[model samples]
Target: MATFQIEGGHQLKGEIRPQGAKNEALQILCAVLMTDEKVYIDNIPNIRDVNKLIEILSNLGVKIQKLGQGSFSFKSDALYLDYLESEKFKEEGSSLRGSIMIVGALLGRFGKGYIPRPGGDKIGRRRLDTHFGGFIKLGAKFRYNKEERFYGVEAPNGLKGVDMLLEEASVTGTANILMAAVLAKGKTSIYNAACEPYIQQLCKMLNSMGAKIKGIGSNLLHIEGVEKLSGCKHTVLPDMIEIGSWIGLAAMTKSELTIKDVSWKDLGIIPETFRKLGITVEKVGDDIHIPEHKSGYEVTSFIDGSIMNISDAPWPGFTPDLLSIILVVATQARGSVLIHQKMFESRLFFVDKLIDMGAKIILCDPHRATVIGHDFESQLKATTMSSPDIRAGISLLIAALSAKGVSTIHNIEQIDRGYEDIDGRLRAIGAKITRFD
Candidate 1:
């Protein structure tokens, strides 16, 4: 129940490195379960969800060693199969949605995977149909109990790969199915699969571990089952969502900041998407630089002079995870933009908090918000608020950093589930933010 008390109006200027990707870390940690040898992973983000996943792995008897800060070596040779059915596992694993990936990894290794209905933010209905459906398509028996709300998949006769098309390009679903298919009996072709950098990185990591997977950055992936996979070292890319957040924060608060080691090649349409919101994001080698804005940036209108619409879609489209930050930054821009958060229904509701802070915004619906820029003419006034989820939480923090007076935010535990040491990092760059009991 810790809270953040932020003294607004500080001009941040310094270099800050984004943490390892949280989304990728989740899949990579689960991928370790596919091999029995020691898997060494570097640049792992020290965050809550990752720690919880590691705890679950430790409880399952996966030998884990902390090599150093943000580095770990994992060996699954000593896994206790019986622990999958333990009440302790169900209680802990269900706390985060990433734990669902463990099921697919277990199915790939031992022909069985079980988990209670997984837990995560109440942003919307994040269905598991895609995951279980993918498993069933690959010769696994999928069962769900209505009373207990448990999901279980088993392939006692061993899994045989089958061509499958996902209902949607669900990222976690793609990872789960890809993991399951890697050790199955035949070639598996997945069309309309998610090709986000996280998923592509998983393919590369799996291939390094001796799994045969083609299509590194495309919607179609082909996996040829191998007898087994071996361990390998993996270094995670920087957190793109965090990089986007820092961009928004720099623009909103008139700060100059440099985000280091972003792996720009993997950031598809992210930097350009921020530039569309009137922020100046420059590519300096592998880093992203945002210069302080004396004259606030203005949103660019379409060629037809109509109101700009920023909507999210699958890979190559603007990321839904960043729509919240864009909406917050648009509040201070010189022009208006309609933020269409198509992926998650309840994400735009956080605009109410911004409106309270003296921003002009309209919650058009659950899925869309229209923000009219104040351009610092009407500066935001600080207020008390609670963080809803990871993206929205960071958005609120960005708003607070740009407001007048002080702002106190609660439920930062939701923020910590994603970002790594956000307050400490902000403090290093001259943000007056502190954590308290």
Candidate 2:
């Protein structure tokens, strides 16, 4: 278990470039299996989860080559189908939540797919019903092995497109179904689909590779079945979650940091969400400049003078992933704010750690938290803690950076699963963080 020993109470000042979108990278990496031609991808982040997926693809006989830094070429002309049934594959596939995506591509191209119960952040109940349900709708026979916790889908005669309405606008679910639909026999119409930027990127990338997909940035997606897909070059967007994290880190630690090439147009409601917490978010040539909040930030009240409430919704609304950072930033703000995490039940449980550090916080329940800011009149006392999930881990690291003394965070592998070389990146920005392996 790796740990991070952070010497707190220091201001960071420098420019940091956000890495490629992790969520998008997962979908894009899986899409390579849909084509036999060479598909070149750029701006892929070297994080643990993404690397694990790439390793799985390589083990499945996909010819992968590193063209350059954060770039790769993949050719899936042949695949080891038998490997999908192997114990080694079950162990590898179950360990990564993103591995479920590969099943869609494999099913679309090879007529069959199998995956173990996938694992990821222990934030809440992340069900795979949406993924499997979408597959069944596309003419695939679904079976589950409760003893082994395994899922299998097979369409021996190839998939046929169908019009279906998704129960939830799940990003991964939509991507999986969309990938399968592109190769189906008829037109597929998806209603109430997730319209996140990552989904749009996947749609556009698929279109570029001979797929007839319409409604790039909307809820309804129409896909015209194509006989074959050809490979094409694609570049991933910068991670909006990481950009949001940097914004929170700047406000909490009173640092003046500039986040470079943030794709400001794609960052809907993120900068504005931070602004609601009284942080200055300036647009400097496609970059986000977060000024130091030496005088402390204030939470903006509602028009009716009610208590400020920050909640997560689907895209075009605030993202749930950043709500943890928002909760941490609200600790030193001028007023109180209620953080309602509608998507997950266990994310708010990490507030107890912040309360231990002298912050005024009320764990309203498993889904909500009420934070009463100390207004910088009281600084959080450093303490040793353990990371719970990727978002919570980064949120705790932000708290540690702003606390009074040295703080130790155990199980930093949770943090590394998402962020790429986070300690090295923070160090470049004048942060006093040391890592112990």
Question: Which lDDT tens digits does candidate 2 get at residues 198-251?
Answer: 999999999999999998899999999999999999999999999999999999
| Candidate 2 clash pair list | none
Give a tens-digit lDDT track for model 1, residues 47-166: 999999999999989999999999999999989988888888878978889999998899988999999888888788899999999999999998887777778999999999899988
Worst 10 residues of 1 by lDDT: 142-151
- Regions of candidate 1 where Cα sits further than 4 Å from its true position: none
Question: What is the alpha-carbon lDDT for the whole of candidate 2?
Answer: 0.95
Deviation in angstroms for 150 in model 1?
A: 1.1
Best-fitting candidate, scored by lDDT? 2
- TM-scores, all candidates, are 0.99, 0.99
